[model samples]
Target: MDEPEPERKVNGMKSIFEEEIKKIQDEIDIFKSGSPNHIAIISEPYSRVEHIYNRILGDNSQKINNIQIFNPVKDTDFFSNFYSNQDIIMMQNCQYLFSRKCCGFAILEEFLDILFSSNKMYITGWNKFAWNYLKEISNIESMFQEIITVPELNSKTIMNLIMSDVSDKVTFIDDRVSEDKKFICFEECLIRMPLSNKEVNISEIKFNFNALKRKKNNKTMEDIQKEAFMDITTLAGGKYDVARKIWKKSLKDGEVRLSRIPQPSEVEISDIDELFILGNILAMDGIDFDELSSIVKNDSLLKQKLYNLVNKGLIEDSDRFYKIYPEAVNSVIDELEKNRMVW
Candidate 1:
């Protein structure tokens, strides 16, 4: 597992929406004034949730020295030394409290019951997918008085963030401009994919993250994606994290032109059982390798499927926890449905 992120990285150095920060501050102000209010900050995994928390801390640290932050997933001393003077408790990774196939909150029920029932102002960060799952299964959303989700990025914002990093190598070339059609192009280069000898021509364009899979009104979800740009954000689906990963991957050979948009993946499911298992993994957001293995109940078969999925670039392994690749998540969902692996 990755070590805890350094505090300097999250201590109000990142830019966040002023209006959203103001709203959070308002909620905190109300709670401090003895109002029954609590806040839940849910964000996309790897997105900018901590920056928001830091912004709140930057603005209020002097007034609330009794505040303490905890990580429910890793911290062991949280419950043992709970102090009554701690009026504000910020907990990160509250999603770890729930388990897909475990016995009753995995011994986290008491901690949560106590944390939520306290009179303090609780600002907890949660994974968006997990929060949604819990909201559906357990009505977990009802516990929070205010919910704030991380804002999606726009093409302009993405361009600003990326260009700042690789400005020396990139040049935004305008291909064609007219009242009827406008095209923004990028400098191109040939780069070899990792573990492959074939050098492919490519060009990279920074796009908004939110546009990754968003469909236009009345448009059918087509198998083949057309080359399109929306205010420069069309390809990314408004997720800056996804765009950054793509850019970093493309920067190995001094900056390759983003020549191709990622195509839909066609992962092979070897059997009915494999198909069902893949669907279950996706439906559960993601699962640990061990958790998935126990559910499948066959060491050899589970290992084989994990190998196949990872090799196909449809599944990812991060610290033994596996999930469908972000780029392939929607495709896998659709493929599973087409095969009737899931309803």
Candidate 2:
């Protein structure tokens, strides 16, 4: 009898930071050639800069033999045992060096002083929001010679990244009916009249070319796969972790369905305290209750406010550490930017 075919399944994918790793390695090469400047890798809060740092060290173990790594948890005393003999220093989650409260800059100032005076080549990972905020308030931007911002993954890259882990063939299914997958959509918008400067509400018809193409041509297997991955990419905002989360949720019985991808619910934040709390959590990537309380300092209503945020599905509490929900990161960022809480 012939050997049985492997069962179709969707397996968890390892994060791929190919371009990011290349850029970091290039900077390391330049540093090895007597360059005095340090390197900084900045990314969105949910992007998980630690993974990139690990990838760099893993890929270039022989080249970077004498490197020290540190991940600070609090605003002070975390870097007391720095190795002076190491030529390379890798610091992940540099955003934790400072809090957003009064007198929070003491530790950050100290760290910068050491960074500036030290002759060793430093490679630091930072949260983009925190980096931008620190740049405005401090001279942190000038300290790093090479600042590499991780760009969002495109649809094709996301598809490859997610599919790389699968051991067997998977199917893509488009189960939506004609009405559900309409090519045309109407959106409400305010436009000024040509003569009068009066604003008017009008419905603008938008055409989804991809949907139209699918409807026009005979749907092929490749078409379905592309559509499913595109939906996942859009919902994830091209972030690798977010896209992987969505892909896992969308996969059922070895079939990826476009309609199964989840979208974040609309979150409205009118309270100033809630907005600041969200921004602070994002800037730090994740914060424990004690640290958050130190910055917020609203003991009476802190618990209730956190409860409200969790109930609204805007934030998540894991082992007393509060973090913006993965699905809600983009929404939270937009809200914070609108409120001028984070850059």
Query: For each candidate, what is the lDDT?
Result: 0.59, 0.76
TM-score between model 2 and native: 0.81
Q: After superposition, how far is residue 193 of candidate 1 from its true place, in Å?
A: 54
| Per-model TM values vs. the true structure | 0.64, 0.81
lDDT of 1 by residue, 50-101 (tens): 6676767766764332233321233445565445555776666666655555
Question: For model 2, what is the error of residue 29's alpha carbon versus the real structure, in angstroms, after optimal superposition?
Answer: 2.4
lDDT of 2: 0.76
Give me the displacement of residue 268 in model 2, in angstroms. 1.4
- Each model's RMSD to truth, in Å? 13.7, 8.1
Top model number, lDDT: 2
Q: In candidate 2, what are the lDDT values of residues 237-303, reduced to their tens digit? A: 7787788887888888988876787755566799998898888889888888888888888876778
